[model samples]
Target chain A: MKPGTDWKNSYRANVFEEIPCGIVVIDRNLRIVDQNLAFTNIFGDGRGQTCYEVTRGRHTPCAECLAEQTFRDGQRRSREAMGVDPAGKPVHHLVQITPIRDETGNVPFVAALTTDLSATKRLQREYQTLFEKVPCYVTVVNRDYRVVKANTLFRKVFGEPTGEHCYQLFKRRHERCPECPAEQTFLDGGSHTSSHVGITRDGTAAHYVVSTAPLVQTDGETTHVIEMALDVTRLHRLEAELLRANALREALVENSPYAILILDQRRRVVLANRAAEKLWDCDRSTLIGHTLPRRAIACRLDEIVGRNGGPAPLVDSTIVTAKGVEIPVRLSGFTLHPVEGERSTAIIAQDLREIRTLEREKLDAERLAAVGQTVAGLAHGIKNILTGLEGGMYVTSGGLARHDEARVKQGWEMLERNIGRVSALVKNLLAFSRGDEPKPRLVRPAAIVADVVSLFKELAEQHDLVLETEISDVAPASMDAEGIHTCLTNLISNAFDACLVSHKPMCRVLVTLREENEEIIFEVTDTGCGMDYEVKQKAFTSFFTTKGSGGTGLGLLLTRKIVQQHGGSVTFESSSNEGTTFRLRFPRRRLPPPVEEEHNGS
Target chain B: MSREPSLHAPRVAIIDDEEDVLTFVRIALEDAGFTVEALDRPTEALATLEAFRPHVILLDLLMPEQMGVSLYTELRASPVLRDVPVIIVSGLNARDTLQEASAATGAGPPAGYLEKPVDAAALLDAVRRALSHSGRGTP
Candidate 1:
């Protein structure tokens, strides 16, 4: 043999074991294959083993064995096969087999070579599983809007894809969705997201949020787009419902009749309603996001939050409008639901100024009617006095014409008595009708009663009436001292007159002054001819008089007016032919607060 | 004798709650040559209506227990006193009271309407006209 020819034989014998490929030699009996080092590393120790058993971990030769065909035809071929390594891990291999020739040009041995492809196969499987198993719907669309790949989730919800168009599968249409984000991505080579509404294979509506990203080729040419979508129909419906509820709440707050305010926990106004605007005389733009200007509103808000989650009760206060008109209001506060993740407070206020004005009008109407009735009563008394005057003058002139001394004296006395009555009537009328506000001050009841009784004692003596006083000393109370004195005097004199007209064996009048139940009571009781039911009904009413022309019927009226001016009251209890008592009560704490005149343009 | 009838004394009945008004009217009527009877209580005046047999009645509108309108109703309802001439004497404006009384009584104005604080001459004149209008006496 030639020397160069012998080198090929030497190279095979020495270099076959280091070839990196798993090289094995098998005879026609498929036994005793020699494998290189790389084969041993992957399959482990294949010397003297059957070729089928060593390469494929099989008991016999494979049914379509490449080595058998190579041996018959002396051809080389490659294919893939799977087996397990010694460690029981799966191994995928690409096997190529060739024939080795004998000296007569006959093949005696076949060579089988294998490359391990297990890692590449594992990556492919992993990708497939990921595509099918993810929770969101995923798909791949070609430039023609065809669904080239669809995940299991997409298939489950929409239907198994059959090379149909993306628009046809998702929207049951031949055309694409308007302003398709996928189309925009293709044009710009950028990613885009959009919300889409479509119908499923089941003909049910579906809402989805889809994102498209460019899938580029090696030359940076975009041929297809990959889409990832989420089925957001349920989430979208819930959002819509929440928006509707928010709108309803806004409408209710805006239209409420009561002045409504929504404040943050920090007491800043977050919302003010129309009524609140009108009540404060400010618009919503000025009111919101600002602390209320009025102290009354601030105080009420503090009361509510300061209590820590409880509602505030109604409170009466005066609020000044933006126009600086002072108006009365009744306000209440309550905890409102969290607004925009913030703790909030709600306030409701009634514009009591309208109610106050209405009440004042009603009182004015009643007072006017009372004045009208009083004028009528005064006229009746005056008319009766006029008749007395005319009679007295006539009798006096007649007595003078007759020149009778005793008759002249009698007529003159009548004239004098009538004149005195007219003066007293005028004084009582003035006191009753006067609108001067009583200036309240502290006074002692016992001392005032003693002083009043002393002045009337002489008159009582002349009338042959007994005036007795039972006064108990007490602490000074708040009242108008002059008005109380006047009321007491009028009552005492009335009682004296009552005693004189009673025709009882003993004409007695009792006066008492004391304090009980936080009230100072001045009582004047008389044993006199008491009144009947009709007199009782019309007692304090106007134009009613039991004393005929001798009384103007205004003395008791004036007494009552004075008592009321002192934040007190006058009441009488009378029984016919038995007695009558008038009680004047002055409550200490009942004095009205001093009126402060409100000014505008502040 | 066909002489002036004003010389004869006529009976006058005055009912009023005001003692001063009753006293004044009684004296004036007596001085004007008329016999007078005064009652303060309207309820008592009802009892004396037949016994007193007055030629002219002076009725006051406002009184305790009964109003002047109610009293007039009572008098008109009575057969014995229905024919007597009534003169409404009121402290209220005489014309207004007469209008109201006339409407309530379903009659024309009374024989005479006298508003109080009246001049002495007006009193005698009203009574005289009331008496003559009743065909009971001449003034």
Candidate 2:
């Protein structure tokens, strides 16, 4: 119960014979006077021998003996010491020495008590290794911002900073960093963070993010700061590069000529370029954050860009103008790389109004040229008719003077017929020059062909030429009957002329009418002099004619226009000296409605 | 205005492409007491001319196979037919045709030029003038 008195009295009574720790009695010369069982177990019963020589297995007094100091000053002292155990293995212990003084107050013997501290010291060494080996630079600084202590990492990276300020060692700077986190930590005794630029011991640049924590005293006095820094140079470089690339990409997208729209994965407009703003006639601020209106986009956009018909822009598409009119456009789309969280799409649109205008102007010019050519041909044709009239009148007057009734009747008939021809020529010329769209009505093409064939039959007498027709009975279909009549007349006349110029004795002109594949086909062929390549190439060109003054060259052009209005086409094949065949095709379902100007204005 | 067509009339060869024009003109000139031989082809007219030995020729300028200007040139080159008067009748603009014919034949147009629907008067006038100018039909 009485620990000090009982335990001490017993140890003194038994002359330190028994205890858990090693006990020894030493004199002023640091020699052991007495030994106990624990001391014998530790130092091997070193009695009447120097304590250092017994415990350390040394032959001389040990350096800095704690018992010598205790004996000289008549005091007790304790220290951590290293010595050998009974097996001669190194042992770590806490050794305490007390002066055992005589009645005259002079110390003669020093009793030493030792505790084994090998396990605790081993744990402390492990903790110190962990602190030094951690990858990041770690250091403790005093209130003066000087590096008070540095770990192995800090010393390796910044060089040994035994007494130098942290800023001086890390950055080679003479003054403290303006926004030092360590200074803040010392002021508030709280953790602070900062990013800094510094240099390494190898003289290479280093970027670091430092976190400073207060190393507070037990009484909460913040006299020092512990700084832990993470080298982040690579991470900073990567972040800066990403920012520059983003800026460059934004610049390119914003400056594109076509309407550029960046859309989020949800198909909402994330951004709109300047062109997009003008094309949509909306401010970028208004359009950017909104989903694009469906009508403002083309339906064929998807088919233009990707497989499986994903969304994009396209040609033959119409864009809704600011005036609410739909104008045709050529559109294109691009799929941008998936960035961050969403894949984006971009669209571009080019307006086609100028092209359409140019097309219309070209058509108008062609029509005007046709009119001019038709007028020239008209003058020549009328001149022929006038000559015929004059000859007829002379014959009839002479016959009348001679009182010859038969000759007079023949001449009168000739005059009447020429007048009829002039009227027909005028009618056809008027029809062609009007330049109105065809009016489709139900009519039989075979009838029109027969009618055209009957118009010119005098060729049999003058030339070795023959005309024939092979017509198939067909149902009445939508067509411009009068226009077809003109077309047939023109073709038949041309065929007859071809037959006339052919030296072949058996020259023939054949007209065919039939229905094939729900389309009506009218073909006129001549086994006469065929057109050459140059003629065929210029067949549809305005005012290109080989018939000299006899042809207006408007016939085929008018035929083509009328056929086109009825959603049909006129094509021909010809070879020099072989033959010629022209075919006009009219699809039954696609005939054009009457001309806009043809209806009564009233 | 007939000067006097003798019982043996001066021969006129007519070459034209149009049959109707040939028929009507032949009847008109024949009734006017001139011997007329009509050929519908200028290519055939040269053969007909050799047989008929016409003292005068009426040529339509725009005949196919051979133009009248060229036929006129051929007649002037021949010793037998050179003295025969050639008159040009065309339905084309007469002044331009005459100029073209003159330029092509390298002879000054023809002995006479007539634009068609040459009435009986114009046809007879041009034919008679051509005959008189060449001193071929001096009835």
Candidate 3:
């Protein structure tokens, strides 16, 4: 059984039909081609049919048929074509056709080879989708930093970037970045990351975290660099805000006007502001952490806390600074409650010096206004009296020239009476001008009222005016006793004088003292020929006289001034021909602390 | 038979709202050897001035109804009394008001200005100066 020539040829044909690539043999007429198993599997049973009908399912030769051209030109040709498989699914095939002749120098048939390209086609589609849909901007650049390929986001963010340098689109610069991550990745062949501030295509500045990786070729050479940029503009803004807030807090604490001092739970100064340093007349470093002296800081926190009869929080208390100057301060504090094992208090001391100064100024202004009103009223009264005197003098002089003795005597008496009136006016004016400057000494108000009544009793008896005293046993008020005595005497004496012209010719003077609220009140009530509206209007005015030639009008003015100096007020209620009652109220309080002067009396 | 003095007596008019002031001025002027006519009321002063045709007039500044300045203005406006001289006797701060009134009344404020509480000698001197300056009588 020696192998015949047909048997060897048949065996080689079987091997060729089983090859992975599809094979077909077509005649010169472009008719049915001899097809291999792979070809029959791809294009389906092609014997006794045209090549176009078998591969393209077309009844005629396909457009731009290279196999027909190859038979005519006796040349070999290759092309990519679309074909359908037995399952009716589309396939892309790489096809090659070569003309074969049987040693006759003529083309008899063409053998075509096709390769399935569906796997490579699907892989390219997947790569395109990933490039387009990734969150970050992605770009591939050549060694020169020029853009080679960019995804849809990269093209949309920095439009049509191919053929332009990546630095130009990302950094908006003509030159590359000084420390470009892409260049570093190319040089190192490893991933490089950096934070960069860049300007976008829309001319907005943004911060980006850019990572670059080298794209290595088969020959171990870095051909391109891939860059991914993540925008971090909002994070940078947050960091800036935090830094600015910290600086503002420090500045506010340093420049606050109030003397602010922080004390630890042990009552030691921990922190002091600029105002505290100046108020204490010591450097901040020296005062901080020092145990506050009890005498210098007069306010005892224990006292206020005990008064509340509970576990007291930080309370408002007076504190004298290191300079030996007393200051009113609001001391508010709270325990650091939640901090475990931390037995500390946060205390803030706000100085009340400015408020005290404002109050002093207001009191001074009120005093001056009262004095001015009194003076104006006095001037008006004096002007009327002077006009009367001028009239009398003119009439008297004329009468003397005419030798009228009766007229002369009347003028002389008028002159004498008016001179006495003027003298009394001068004396009262002097008294009012020199108001009682309070020489405060602790004394019982009831005793003063009793003494005043006793002194005036004889005078009241002589004037047919009864004097009575009703004194209350109250707490002693600090005041000038002599001022109180003088005021009571003047009031009682006026009551006696008022009764002189009344038809009834009877008068009553009552002096009483009592304590109400935190104040002591001394009241003087009189029943006599009470004042009319006009007289009452000018009651406290200097030089206003209801007794014609007897009244000097400075009594009540002086009394009021004296009462006010003792931290008290003088007020009255009166009705025409009814009676008059004067009440002097003295608050049970001491004079406010003197304002801190930049320098003591110079 | 007695012979009367041939020398003419100077006639003076004193106008003031106060009767005592008018009487005092009359006495002072008469003692200085001048015939005087005193009018206490401002309205009556103008009538008395016309009748007496005085060589000098003493006028008080402030009065009811018609003040010294207004009376002076009215007197200067009349043709019959335009030549009469008026001396404003006032207790007011009168330096500025007198000057202003002098400009308003063409006859001028007075030959001399006198304040209140005027002495007899000063009053006599002003009358004499006014009469001599007006050429109405020899001082």
Candidate 4:
């Protein structure tokens, strides 16, 4: 071999065999002249063969061949082609063919450069599948707002939105959106997000959150906007429903008749109903989130705490009003444990003043009825006795007319006795009828008993009877002290009179004061000539006196009437010649105030 | 010719269940120079009214068995005694019953109704007024 020729061949072999891309040199007849190792590896080593046969395994020249085009036009040409290799695998190639001349101005050869695009084509197919199958709607639009490409969901949502203005398909508007995110993305080449309500081609409305990004080409030019829209109509509906429910609950609580107050774990007032506002006589807005005032009416805060802390059992208390009026109330509190954090207490307050007033009225009416009945019966009996006295007087007057000294003196004496009897009866009646009104005051039961014992001491001594008292130091009770004094005096007098009739003539009257269930009890017990069944039955009945000539029989009846007015009751136990015990019990609960004015003009 | 002198005084009968009231009225009528016959028993006094033929009859209300209103009703039912003027004296608080009874009775309800306990002068005046109205001479 010649030295220059050897060097030229060695350089050609090294250059042709080592190139990374597939290279082929075709002659003017469109035959393969030279090829690299990569080209043979890709096209299966066909030597001196037609270019179409070597690359495509076809016997004839390839249709629309770049080399042929380049040879004819003497200009570089490039085209995309699909070819088959020796293994029957399909390959995509981008081929560039250029004419080469040997300084003679005549085209001698075509150098064809082929770039395999199979990997790039496969990637594009995968991207198309992802775009078609994604759940969210995806679309591509040009800068002019015209849809360039759309996925299946995008087409289904906007009905083949391609080639149409993106705003027309997504917003069903004739014009572009004023602040479209896609337009912003195209301008800035950045991603943007927006939420808006859109109408579909079928006129169905939907809420959507759309994200848009600029699609930048390899030349760094943003030619399209890629948008992804997510539907959020259901979430919007849920938020609306929650708001409605909250409004309804607020309305119900505000209008409730019961005084309702909601307090946080820290005992601060969080919410209060209109009733609570009215009850406290404070503005509702001012009460919210404020610590409960110490001077809450109806009951002291400490007393309520003593009853039970929230959630408290139903309890009764007296609440003081802003005006310092104490009112009876029932307070109940319960804890509300919501799904979220801290527990709160809901307190309900019910006013009890009206019910208490009604109870008092009923008791007053019953006492009036019982007293009226007794008065009527007493008046009837007194009238009968008066008639007897008058009858005796008539006989005495007739006797006096006979002019016998003995008869005259006897008649005078008899008239004197009957007159005295009638006078005593009138006195007793007057005493009972007077002082029906109660003058209530705080008094100790023991003190009243002591006073009665002292007042009756002389009478007891004269009658040879023993009168003693046992007093308790329990809390004082409110009552009509004068009325109770009268009651005790009458009982002691009766006991002294009874002792005079007993065999031993020994009278023992015991007055005791005790406390039971927070009630003040006064017991008057006597051991002297106890009454029989018949007398006991008529003991409290007016004008049924057992003391033949002296007794007026209004004492026990009046005693019971006064005791009943003080929210108390009187009961007795008696046995023939053994003993008689009268007990009066007064409750510690305060009496209700008078409902009606004491005096009426009518 | 000398007329036979009247031997007995004309009698005025007073009926009441109350003895003190009866004695008081008897004294007043006697002092007024009229014979007074007071009876405690309504039934007995009614018999005396039939026998004695009192110029005026005073009736007390609210008596046992026969009330003043009922007694007045019985008297008016009799043709002979119905014309005799009757007065109702009552101690009851209700004057309506007395007025109603007087209006219902045909005999003009005792020339004057008196309430107990009747004063002496008032009782005398009532008796005189009743007798004078009946055209009867005082005893």
Give the whole-model CA lDDT for all candidates, comma-separated.
0.79, 0.76, 0.72, 0.73
Any residue pairs clashing in model 2, and if so which?
A301-A312, A302-A310, A387-B117
Tens-digit lDDT string for candidate 2 (A283-326): 88877777767777756446546544465545568877455777
Model 4, A303-329: lDDT tens digits are 433233344666787555555666678
What stretches of model 3 exceed 4 Å from their correct place? A1-137, A151-158, A170-172, A197-208, A216-218, A229-249, A259-273, A276-316, A320-602, B1-139
TM-score of each: 0.56, 0.45, 0.43, 0.40
Q: What's the TM for model 3?
A: 0.43
Model 2 agreement with the true structure over B1-139: per-residue lDDT tens digits: 3234465898888887655577677887777788778887665677679888987888876554456667777877766887777787775555665577667766555677776656777887888887777766533
* lDDT, candidate 1, A1-602, per-residue tens: 99987998889776888887787788888875577888888888877888777666789778988888988899999998897888877789888888889999888998888888888788979988987987878888888888889999998887777788888877788788887888988888889998888886767788888899887543666788888888898998899999999999888888888889888877688988999999889888988998766563535566534365555778777677778877778877878675468778788888887798999999999989887887887787777777777777876777788786775776677677778888988877777767788866566667788888899888877877888988888787666667778888878877876676666878889999888888878899999977667678877875576666556677777787888877788899998778899998878788655344456747
Return the number of clashes found in candidate 4: 9
lDDT of 3 by residue, A88-125 (tens): 78989989998878888888898899888888878879
In model 2 chain A, which range of ten residues has the least summed lDDT?
A: A543-552
Local lDDT at A253 for model 2: 70
- Name the better of 1 and 4 by DockQ: 1
Best by TM-score: 1
- Output the better candidate (1/2) by lDDT: 1
In terms of lDDT, the best-performing candidate is 1
Q: Which stretches of candidate 2 lie over 4 Å from their true place?
A: A1-343, A398-413, A430-522, A529-562, A575-578, A587-602, B2-139
